[model samples]
Structure formats: C-alpha cells, structure tokens
Target: MPTNGGQIKTYAAPEGVAVADAFLIYARSVDSEPWIPVSTYAVDVAEVNTTRNEFDKHPISVASFDMDGPVEVQVKYTLNKVQSAAIRPKSLGIQAVIDGDNTITFSLDRPRDVMLEINHDKWQALHILTNGIDHNALPSDSQETWYFGPGINNGSPYGLVTDGNLFVPSNTMVYLAGGAFVTFKLNFIKVCNSGVRGHGFIYNGPNGGAILIERSENIVVENVTSLGATGFSLTTGEAKGVTISGYRSFSSHGNGDGVDLFCSSDILVENCFLRNSDDTIAIYGHRWDYYGDSSNIVIRNCTLLPDIAHPIHMGTHGNPAKPETISGIHISNIDILDHYENQMWYQGCISLSAGDENLIEDVHIQDVRVERISKGQLVNMRVMKNEMWTTAPGHGIRNVTLKNISLDATNSQIVNPSQILGFDYTRKVENIVFENLNIGGQYIHDGMGKPRWYMVADLVPMFINEHVTNVKFILTK
Candidate 1:
C-alpha cells in the first residue's frame, strides 16, 4: 500500500494459517487515501496450564506491517458489542477516535508495538506491530547471504534431516525475506560473526526454541519475528558478545519465555517486543550444560507482556556447589504492558529470586513504565530455597538500585504487595535503593508527609521482610 510520501507493506500468512474474524483492520498513509486491507492473523494466548479450552484460549489477533513513515489506521470490531476501547502502554497517550461503538481510528507516527483492547478485555486484544523498512537487508543474490524468499520454507537444503532443526554454520548470514515463513528450530552453535536478519516470521510450533545460540560469539538476530514456540523463543546459553535488536516474539505454550540467557555475558537486547506465558526475559547464572556466571547484560527499550509469570526474572538457577555469581545487569527504558500471575510466589513483574547458591549483585533498573498489573506484585527480591526450582538457598541479593520507576494502577488492579526478603542471617539482602519510585502519580520517598513512625515501604505499600537491610527510597529529580 504505497502513498505519495509514505508506504506500507503487508505479509500474507502461509496456506493453512488461521485468520481471525474478530476484527477488520485497515491502513492508509493519510485520511484522503483509500484504506488498504490488512491481514489479521489469529494467535494462541492463555493456552497454558489448561486443556486448551476455547473460552480460556482468548485467540488474540496480530496485524503487522512494514511502514516507511507515519500512517493512519482503523479497526472495526463487533458492532454494538464494544462499550469501550483502549490502546496501551497508556504512557504513549494514543487516543482513539471512536466511531460509534464498533470502530476506532488512530494515527501512528513511529514504529511501535501496541495492544488494542475492546470492552476492557485484557486477554483478547489485538496487537499492532509496525516495523520500519530493513535498509540493511542483504540482497538475495549475495554470496555471503543465504536467502529464504517469500513462501513456506523448510530446512531441507540446510541440513534439517529428522530433528526439524536447521544449523547455520559459522561466518554465514541467513536472510529471511519479507513474507517468508520458516518452520524449524534455527540454531547457531559455536559460530562467530554470523547473523540472521530481515523481516520474516519463524514459526516453530510446539517444539523447542525458535532460535537458539549456544557457545557462539559475535552473533546478532535482528528484526525477526518468532511465534508459537513451546520453549523459549530466543535463547542464549554459554554464549557471549551477542546483540538482539528490533526482535518480536509471541507465545502461548508452557515455559514460553521471550529471551532467556543462561551462563552468558556481554549481551545487548534492545527495541524488542515480547509477549509470553512465562518470563519475558530471564537472566540466569547456570542451567543444563551451560556452567558459569552470567554478567554484563543490558536490556533496554523493550515492551514486555507476561501473561503467567514475571517480566524480568533473574538469579534463579546456578551451581549449588561452586556458588556462581550473577552480576552487572542494567535494564532501562522498558514499558511493561501487563503482568498476570495467580501463584503468589511466582508473581512479580521484576523478580530477582536468587537460589541455587547464586550471589546476585550490582543490578540496576531505571526509567521503566508499568501500565497494568492484574494479579501480581511490582517487585520481588528474595534469596531463599525453593524446592520446586532450586536445591539450596542463594548467597544473597545485594547492591541493587531502581530509579524513576512508575506504575499506573488507575485502570488496573494490584492484588499483592512487592516483597524483599532473605533466607537467613548469613544470607541477607542488602544495599537496596529506590529513587523516584512513583505509583499512582505519587512519588514514594523517605521524606514524604506521613506519620513519623511510618516506614518508607508503608508509603509504597511494600513488604520488607526479615534479613533485608539498607533499603532506602530517595527523592531524586
């Protein structure tokens, strides 16, 4: 759909792909132009921990496109059924021009991923994913690039025999062009200076990870969309010097983490959108054959929506005998859309539940906006032994700082308080600070006007359990 100054490109799903009838979507460059029909695909959501009930499935919709610039959009839902409509983060302040009770119109200037809800329905919202044109996409005829053009591409030519897995060798660049649907586990093992880029979708359904990087360095996976993976979508274990930018992932199956790193270091994950049934991004010390400390990771400018678990979870798995350390993590400029978890112990948007004799320290989270928390806590920093996932208690969680963290609970529900606890006297959580923590338009600090006997957590409504020391909230402008 090309206009005078702006253009839009849409991808058709493969044959046998399911299309959604819940909404009709269209796009145009301006108000005077004719609207082009956008393909709306049905994606599974809330299908974990259950028997795939239709009522509980939700059957979310996604409309994606590549745009050159700003564009106008419209969405039409069931007539007279929608009493309300909203688009979030809520910080974006994207107002919809409601046309009666069934249609809404909006404008998008920048490429972003947004959720559109009807009648305040949280589970069955439509995701509008807009991406810019891939200017650095390699040509199809390049010798260094192995290109998969538009269509359903299996891994027959790339050594996919019986396992439904495709291994990309070292020093190679694999490009999945627009409208290409790849159906295999793309693995990069022991490779250097390799990458997989372009505007394509990797659909590895009900199997292992969508893209796995193990024992590899100097690798990048950018601007690629992955959906319907049963395990982690994009994972790195025992790998280093990796960058994942402009990536998108969606999953509904059990243990469907967005970007999980185990025993890895020096990673940068930015400008990504992840909506999953488990943690959106988890950083751990050691797991499986990946044995070492996880350090120097930066995750910024990403949107995370966790339907069943935490958004940013870390320090849960490590070596119990050697006592590994997970340190030097910085997470900033994040927009957490929604977090819903029923289990009390496993419900936090930012959780650092250290276990398996791991020592987690020197972590910082700043400039984050949390829009909705349906049934979870804002933060959970604990060092305890959980028999379900860990064998021993952690050493401690220390030297953590959170700055300019804001949560908007005006139109949402928060059922639990944030927790900070430690295991015993020997293992304590210390040196924690919260600067400019805002909740419901109020900054929670130490000098707030409250009763003299009230602690700082009383204002923020947090729980400072035993063995936690040196926790302070400062009013930093």
Candidate 2:
C-alpha cells in the first residue's frame, strides 16, 4: 500500500450505471504528484463449470486509461478482508508494496494490461487496462465522424438501430466518446474502409457478438472497451486487411471468446487485452459462411487472460472436402495471464488442434510468458478428427516453432503435461522445434544434463508422442 501519487489521466463510465465498489483505484504520473481517481466499472464474469451449462456470474472490477508515459498505480480493496494480494503475469516481475492492510501500490513504466487479485481469488480480480496515447484520435465534432456522446444511445442520426443492432455502412467512421455506453452489435458487414474508434463501452445482449466484421475489407477497430458479451467480443469472418489495436474486452458467458478470426487474412491484432471465458484469440480456416484459407496474421504485444480456455488457439475448424491450409501466423511478445480448462480435448494454453482436414503450417510463436495455468497444459499440437467439431481428420501440422517461451507454474499442482501427437501415420506432426524453452527456472535443452537412456522429452514435463518427426530442442542462451 504505497501512498505515492502523481499527475495521471483516467476515464469514467456513464452516470446512469453505478460504479463498482470492489476496489478503489487511483493513478499518477510520478510519486510527487496528486492522485487521479479511476472509476472501476462493474463487469460480470463467469465462474464456469465445464461439467454443466449453467454458469454463475462473478462480478469483477475494470479500469482503463490512456498512458502517455510512466505511471504509478494504487489500489485499495474495499472488501471486508484481504489476507494477501497479487498481480499477474508474474513474469512481469512487478513488485507491489503493501502500505496498509487493504492497499497496495505499483509502478508501470509503460502501458500494460494486468490483473490484481486479493486473497489469491482470481475470479473476482480487478483488470487494469492501459493503452498508449491516441495520437490519431478523431475529433469529437469532426464532420467525418459519427460521434455517440455520453449515456445510452440508440436509434440515432446514424440510421437503423433495431433490437440493439447497428449496421455500419462502408467508408464510415464511428466514435464512442468517454462514458458512452452502446449496447448495439456494431456490425461491419461487407463494408470497406470502415472503422469504429473510441474509448467507450459496447455491450452485447445474448446471442450475437459485440462487434462483428463479416465479408469486409480494410476495417480498423481500435480502442473500444467491450463489456459482458455473451458470445464473442470481436469476431471477423472472411475479412481482409483488418487491424485491431488497443482493444479491451471482459466477457463471462459460456462461449465468451475474444477476437475470433475465421477464414480471414492479413490481419494485425496488437496491444489488446482480452479476458474472457473461452479462447482469447481463436483463428480458424472456415466456419459457416466464412470460407477460405486463413493466412498472413500477426498477433503480438497482447495480454490474454482466459478464465476458462486457451490464450492462443488455431486450426480447429476448416473445410474438409476442399482441404484448406491455415498458415502464415506469427505470435510474439504475448503475456498469457491465466488458462483454466478441464476438458482435455480443449486444454492447452497454446493449442493447435488441426481438425477438419486443415493443414496447419508456418507458425512461429516466440517471446511468450505464461503465468499461473490453473488446470491446463502449456502446449498441445495434435491432428485430430473430432466429430464434435469437425467432419474429417486434419491433413497435418508442420513447420511450427516455439522459441523463447517461459512458463512459471510455481505452486500449481494441476498443470497437465503438454502433448504433441498426430492422428495417424498419414497425418503427422513434422518439423517442430522448441528453442530456448524455459519451465520453472530450468531450461529444457538438448545439451542439458540428462540420463543417457532418457528421451529428450524426459528432460522436461512434456510428452513427445508418436507420429511426430524432426522435433528438436536447442539451447540459444
């Protein structure tokens, strides 16, 4: 509980909705300045039980702001008791000073998306989302922008808003001002050069998603805070040249996936904070009407906090008959906060389950830090023919590299051993390499001391199963 505060910027939610009292958060630029209050918005997340469909809502607190420089943050837990508190991803090495019984303070040198948990309770944590200063923010009164002011807005000058759905036309720009709450699904369907940029909140009701980009091109969705989406936070299908940056989402429903890309290409998702019940970022080849080979994607510098599922998943769904290829993916510099999943079929913090005859290839995942995986494995690459989600078996998975990956399961006893398996002799996993892989302060490399009779996988806690060829672990450090 460090009492230091300074000049900083913060945002607030709308007036109609009451602020959450779970945590009292403040921010400042330096220790010598006064503190600025940051409103903690109430967000309902799910405490999911995979054995049943019925879920319970666990309300959490979230605060967001734009950081132009280094900032000091202070948080005071307002609950009755707080035995101990912690912040994650422990890989960040952010040390907190406890100045009081219920207060803690930490300093951030730059913008980061982190969670604060009191009494080691993760379900009711506080999410602090920060982004770089918007240098190209649209003016509030710009003639080219459709600005939605503060408060709940529906059926406006932008035209047809029915049943909490708004279809944005082509070449249009929409902005949600600070404290503005829009419950509509901002649909960018078949539109070109359209974007939604703001610092506001978008809430989805039940069936649909918060923001959808379908059959669209050159679309940009930046700096939008999505709250409590029952489905996905932002889903893109058959889209091209899409850029998703500085986005934040908190979802708690059954299938609350974040930033799902289906049969899309040339996408860049960076500097985003996604905390959901399901896969934080799922990339697939084909699903429903979205049909193509999903390729050329880059997901970097993002923080994925999955309360239920994988942080990075790919190649699950595809066209079996035509046999699509899901390739050209690069994921780097990511911090996976938590991954909790009980189902073995869907239990991997970084999973590549190639189903539906999809040939998954050319993937590079590097510079990642995985912290506190409560129930899932660190990695799972398998060629499967799961009838539940696919029609036929996948072709194979090839040329995948995991470099500079670190996982810290300090006190976790439920972490499953990672696996890499092929469906059969025909569908094999080939040319896989783990370069500079570190687990629990020990590097898993070939040159490390190991029994001569033991296999390479015996050096670590993973299983290099059958039908996997050309797997190597090299020490680069």
Candidate 3:
C-alpha cells in the first residue's frame, strides 16, 4: 500500500450522533504535482411526498482526489459500532482490515471512486476518488486553443466572462489551469468537434444548469469538477457522438439530474462520480425540439448516489404523436450507493418506465451491486401513462435482461421487491429474463410464488402482472 501523510481529512457529523472520521489517500504522479482532494458537505435529505424541501444540516463528509495511471491506496476510518463493512462496486476487490487501533483500513486500486460503508448501512459516506486525466501539460496559445490561466482574464467572444461563464463556439478547445477556481457554466450550442476540459472547477449558480450541449455533435467534457447546478449538471439534447469521461459532479437542487440525455445517440459516459438529487443518468426519447429515438448509449464503470431518485432511469418522456423507440442500451459495473423516493410508481434503483407511446427494448444491465435500497425497489420495469407528462400509454417493453445483480437489504425497512408490469393486454411487456438475481443472498426465481398483481395500496414482494409474458428466471447456486 502507498503511504502518504495528511492527504486525508475528516468532517464531523451531527452534534450528538456518533460518526467515523473518514480518511482519503492519493497517489502522486511523477509527471505532475501531488493531488489535493476536494472536500464537500453531504446533508441528510429527507424524503418529500410532493415538493422539494430544504436539506438537513450537513452531517456527512465527502472527499475526492485525482490520480493518473494505476496505484494502490488505503483508506483508514474509525470503526464505529457495526456488524458488517463493505466497499461499493465489489467488483473492484477492495480489501478491508481492522487495525490494532480499532480502525478499518481499506485497500484498493486507483482510478476509480468508491463509497465506503460501515455496518450494513448508514448515512455517512466517504467518496474516494482516483481520477485519471490526459493532456495535463498546459496548452500553447493558438487560434484553436483558448487558454484561461490563473486569475480572471476575459477573452470577450471566446473565453470566460467576468462572472466566469463561457459560451464555447464550435471547433475550439477551452482549458483551465490547475488551482483555477472559475464560477460559471459552459454552454456548447450547435457546436461540433469541441471540448471543454481542465483540472479547474466549474461552479453553476442556483438558477441554470452547468453545461448545456444542444443540437451539437462530437462534443467532449472531461476532468472537470462541477458543483451546485440548479438544473442538470450536464444536459445533452438532440446531440450526437457525445463522450463524457473522468467527470465529477454534485447537485443538491431539485430536478438536478447528473446527466440527462434527451434524444441523443452514440453516447458513452464512463469513469465518473455523480451524487445528484434526481436521476443520475436519465435516457429519454424525443421531447420538445429533440425529436428522435436514442440508441447506442453505454454507461459503465461509474459510481452513482441518487440521494433523491433513481440511479438509472429510462423511457420516461417521449412524444405521444411521434412515438419513438429507445434501444441498444448497456449499463454495467455500477455501484448504486443509495436511492430514496416515496412515490412507489417512481421508485427504483434501476427503472425503465416506458411512457408516452415509446417502445423501450434491447437493454442489458449486468454486474450491478446495489449496496442498499433505502426506500425503493431493486428493479422496476413498467409500461404505463403518466397523466402529468404523457399523452398516452407506452407501446411495450421487450428483450430486457438483468444478470448478476445483488442487493443488500440487510438494514432496510422497506424491502420493496422488483416489479415487471405492463399496461394491459394490448400494450404489454415480454421477453424479460433474470439470471443470478440475488437479494440478501437469496435467489429470486419462479419458485417464490405466483404472479402478484399490484394495486394502489398493496405492498407485495415481487410482482409480475398478467400482462407481462415470457418471463424467465435462471437461479444460480
């Protein structure tokens, strides 16, 4: 294990509540200076029934650090009164050992962010980041490259303004140096072959979103730490060939989705950390001017903590008149830390609610380890109509597969099981398969019971309405 001193910092919890002093470690690259972790306050957000409410006091601590290449780091934490401990995305193979001082040490490879949990579940989360970046060397001044060095320098039509927000044009590059603290959003509108990247911070005020890529193509946003977007952290609408990597975001506002894709195609989102109040990654069909089906989208190797909503949501919004279809989606190797929602119809860690006459199919969700479902279900696949959003019900949902999904509901009071339902006989869901689906170390198969039809106030374990057909479950020993 790499031993570095004082790189970690601890934040105190509430006045009376007992919490652990979390530690973070970072590996120094010979090519660059030592990485300084960003410390943010995490609040205990209560579940609201209708509208967005104010957050509780900042009782939890979150730390993030960046590193290049591969390295091993150890996180040491004060062991609280606990029964079990786990590092999220167990595929990372993090090893924990209790030191003689009664502290726990976690060892893992770098270039990823993981949530450290004590006992079976608690609210105090230590978000460790091992970020990787390219092109760290400063860029030379050129017509194609727009550089913003230390301090504020406004390049009227090209670079940031006095308030630090910049509207990037097409065929350009915007770079912010290290230690640069800029407070503005980056807007890429109808641009092509452009990128906004840096080690600097992008602070979105409490009104608009941070980054907007509308009707753009070949756009890239990487290695940026974004905080406090009233809207989405990154919103891509009617865009194509968009790639978002090595990004970290935190949103505490209502409807502040991490990455909302509307009618976008050929997208790849990987190696990111998102702690949002809404859906972390929402893939929707046509809406407003963005009118088309979304395809070939892949989101993997990420850590998602939806403090208020779903981690992966799809097919919620679409044009009822046009009726588009969303297909060819793959989500793998994800760690869902915590999902909180009170609305049963909109409660899930992974939800595919095909609404507004859309046909959502060909989805593959594999190797997902959900640490805790605080208030929602494991998986919810439904085809229905949202009276507030959709004009008509969805067409159907078919050929969706869930494999190697494990949920730890040990300390959860709401053990809401998964559901796969269709609207009616005319618009149904079919060809759904589950392989090695284990909840609290128990395999869910056909041997559980008959299909439990859901009603308004009924609380069932697992539901498969009659309208859902061709459901297969292959249990693993």
Order of the predicted models by lDDT, top scorer first? 1, 2, 3
Say which prediction, candidate 2 or candidate 3, comes out ahead on TM-score.
2
Candidate 2 TM-score over all chains jointly: 0.94
**Worst lDDT window (10 residues) for model 2?**
1-10
Q: Which tens-of-lDDT digit does each residue in 81-177 have in candidate 2?
A: 7677777767678887777668889988887778887777786588887766656765564545677766666215335677667888888888876
Give stretches of model 1 more than 4 Å off: 1-6, 47-55, 154-162
lDDT of 1 at 408: 84
- The sequence of per-residue lDDT tens digits that candidate 1 reaches over residues 1-477 is 122224777777667667788888988886456787777778876634444432244578887777877888899985347777888767788887788758889889878888898877766588888878777766574656678776677223445424777788788888987777787888899999888888777876435678999999999998888877878999999999999998888887778889999999999999998988789999998778899999999999999998878999998899998889999999999999888887788988889988999999999999999888888888899998988989899999999999999888785696588999989989999999999999889999998899898888977789998799999999978
List candidate 3 stretches off by more than 4 Å: 1-53, 57-62, 68-86, 96-108, 117-123, 133-136, 149-165, 446-460, 475-477
Give stretches of model 2 more than 4 Å off: 1-7, 132-136, 141-143, 154-159
**Candidate 3 lDDT tens digits, 1-477:** 112323322222223222225543333343334543333334332234464455532334454444444444444444355345577666578776655543455544456677666665545556655444433545445687777543333233334453545778889877754333355778788899998776555655434677889889999887776666777889899999999987777766778788999999999998888888789999999777888999999998888888788999999799988899999999998888777777788888889999999999999999888876778888899999988878889999999999988887684557576788899998999998888887778777755554476331132356888899897777665
Q: At residue 41, what lDDT does model 3 achieve?
A: 33
